[model samples]
Target: MRFLLVEDNAELADAVVQRLGLDGHAVDHAGTLAAAEDCLAVAEYDLILLDVMLPDGDGRDFLSRHRDHLETPVIVLTARSQISDRVGALDQGADDYITKPFDFSELEARCRAVLRRRGGAAKNEITLGEAVFDPMAGTLRHGAQVLDLRNRELRLLEVFARAQGQILSKGQLLDRLFSMDADVTENAIEVYVGRLRKKLDGVGVRIETVRGLGYRMDT
Candidate 1:
């Protein structure tokens, strides 16, 4: 999984990033809101570990600004242990809140639990005709053969699988796969979809293009 850590404390940030890396997650660190915004603009993170206080602004403000558009889960890490602080963060759509001087183990567990719950809510395996994608393992299987997929391809598959038969626009896919600040054009999504279509064809999975509407998985 990929993560973004937004914390200004140099030492604390280093420790958290190293610990999370040791846990097998690719982590990116940002020391300020601007830096964090830049990272968020280009990368699609699985989870965001946001510090309540930053050099420029409060994390809550950032969450308020982007919560509607970004679906990635967020966990607020703050020194404020007040009930109001916790309530405000949750009300702003944070998935969880952790107080400062927190146990690293507990933080790791919370991250895992939140991700597990999200995956559980959206089934790991999606079946469309003869094709099945095991998202947890990042594998695409068809009958006896297993197809190779790139990271972006797997992310694309997850989006389609989660949506099932629903029509998803190219814009929507880009938003989900890339950050809002990404400089990628809409055509980039089409390219990825085209590549995915070829792989799906090789395995007998039916991914249909709905003309101007975009793509869908036909079961």
Candidate 2:
């Protein structure tokens, strides 16, 4: 998963970025609403961890303004413990809300919960033929064996699995695998795809190249 963390607290932002990175998710930090807007203009994210009290403006107001066109889920992170604050965030289209000084584990669980709900995953595990993907644990299993996939390879597979059966262009894959801050090219996606294909060979899930268009996964 890719995330945009809109926060001004450097320490909290750094900690969130590191924790999510450890789970194989790419994250971009935006210390202010202006920076967050710039990041949003350049890339797409699976989720947004937004801090209410940004350096420049309120995050809830930002959410209110963009929620109409933004399909990505947003989880409001704030120090406000009032019921009105939580209600206001939800009314502004926040998918979830987390209080400040919360545990990293809890934040991770909330992220997974929001993603699962948004992705229509009722269960934590997604089974494709004999392969089972645990989005939370970032692991893939085939029958009795666990696949030793590289981080990029696993990320590619996760992207394909989430949007299964839909055609995804190389450009779309590139954005999902690498963050806007990362120095990567469109052709790098092909290299990762090739490697992932070799690993998923006979796993009952097929990655089909759609001629000049892109690729699609079929189970």
Candidate 3:
């Protein structure tokens, strides 16, 4: 997925862009409302992470401006956590709202929630054999027992569990595991895959490597 991040703060934009990029999404940064409008004019984006305060104009006004034509999901980011602010943003066509100083995990979860709604996916948990994986919550359950997993493991497993039957190449796995800021090599994926495979040992699942192709999860 490609995202347009409409933010004025350079630090926040860098952090969010790097995070989204690590999730294998292409992100474009626009520091002002005009830059955002210009990017929206020519390019297509799956999502927009918008800051309510901008140098040129209010982001909520921007939402109202493209209310009729913009079908992509917009999640508002604002320092103001007032009820009226949240209500106004939603009323103006924002898909979801996030307050400032939010947990990055929550932001990721909210993004998935909006995307799921857009794709008409009603279920939040995915089942692979006896193991149940919740991408939003970042949890895995095997029967009544819940497995503790690292952040990287959870991210990697989510990718496979979401696409249980499809094969993902090493390049794809690398994309899922690390981004531009992540100074990791292709071999890093092997280490994670090995660890994840062991973690799911008795969980009634296996990740198989296809020669000359990639990897697939068998449930």
User: Best candidate, lDDT-wise?
Assistant: 2
- List lDDT for all candidates, in order: 0.82, 0.90, 0.84
Models 1 onward score TM values of 0.61, 0.91, 0.67
**Using TM-score as the measure, which candidate wins?**
2
Candidate 2 lDDT over residue span 23-64, tens digit each: 778999999999999999989899999999987999999999
Quote model 1's TM-score: 0.61
The global Cα lDDT (0 to 1) of model 1 is: 0.82
The better-scoring model by lDDT among 1 and 3 is 3
Candidate 3 per-residue lDDT, tens place, 27-136, comes to 78899999988888867776899999999999999999997999999999989989999999999999999999888889988999997797677977888788888766
* Tens-digit per-residue lDDT, 17-108, candidate 1: 77775543557789999999998877788899999999999999999999999999999999998999999999998999999999999898
- For candidate 1, list the clashing residue pairs, or say none: none
Q: Alpha carbon lDDT of residue 18, candidate 3?
A: 78
Can you give the lDDT of residue 30 in candidate 1?
A: 92
Which residue pairs in model 2 clash with each other?
none
